[model samples]
Target: MKNVSDEELMILVSNGNLDMMSILFDRYHVRIYNFLLKMTRDQDVSQDITQEVFYKVLKYRTSYKKGKFSSWIYTIARNVFSDHYQKQKNKDQRLNDIHYKTIGQETNSVDDEEIKEQLHLALMKLSHSDRELIIMNRYQGIKYQEIAEIMDSTEGAVKTKVHRAIHKLKEYYLQKI
Candidate 1:
């Protein structure tokens, strides 16, 4: 039900109330998709990964414990992204080579669109873990405590990481400008 909490819904799902899974999906699919899209920068890949994340949630339903559902789902999403990244490292390298070839020839304009584009490009240039921190804390609006739970680290550590990631993103964005 829409009035029930996410953890309660997941508990119901874990108890074999399969229809509750749809409610969970409807609640989170867009957020998860956007998170993946920000990380992958590929629409098709993000869609596939988003589907895979839900599939994983269903598959592991029995393992669901009484906790914050958001944290559990994000942990699953992060793992899925990491697995995809590992498997596609070589292909990514080739794509990066092609991307770099074209990047040099692009004009360094300072229009509104150009600034937004440069910010996006700078985000993409960040290390995967750093980018994840920024995407989670800045873009996705996840609290540091929830991020720490998902990352299996202390809240203090998450705060520090997010701070450093934002600093790096700003430096890179300024360089692009």
Candidate 2:
């Protein structure tokens, strides 16, 4: 069979073709997990959020609209992250602790890893919207137009938000240093 686009796979999934789900999952799972991992900085939370994103995708497939499928999934991922953060008021502090330990274990050079740790800390200091804009633009490589669609804002607004987010991140890095 020919490969289906993510939108096509979602349409298939909505039509009750259960087999299409795995294809959709395969296409997006790694990126979603990695995005969540970068946001939450917890492997387990990333796993849970990734699972939730798919579950929401499957459960709400009937409601899928046309446009960029990745944006739809990204909107879902953002909701999942927000819900998780709401449940744990100290989420950043928890992730901060885990972030250092993870860098220590994963990187060969302590200095490079420490810089990563510092960056992670800087990211944590950013506002939620600022962090999300960076994630959508930088990590996910989402186009500003698509991000505007997902965010329900104008493309110009998305551009401004991303620019402001970058400025905030810079301030965060400066403060950390």
Best-fitting candidate, scored by TM-score? 1
Model 2 ranges with Cα > 4 A deviation: 90-105
Tens-digit per-residue lDDT, 16-90, candidate 1: 999999999999999999898778777777899999999999999999988899999999999998988877775
- Per-residue alpha-carbon lDDT of candidate 2 for residues 8-111, written as tens digits (9 for 90 to 100): 87777888897988887888899899888778877878899999999998888889876679889989999988888877766554433453226226667878
Q: After superposition, how far is residue 21 of candidate 1 from its true place, in Å?
A: 0.4
Estimate every model's Cα lDDT from 0 to 1.
0.88, 0.82
Candidate 1 displacement at residue 98 in angstroms: 8.3
Which structure among the candidates has the greatest lDDT?
1
Give the Å shift of residue 46 in candidate 1: 0.5
Give the runs in model 1 whose Cα sits over 4 Å from its true position: 90-110
Candidate 2, position 160, lDDT:
95
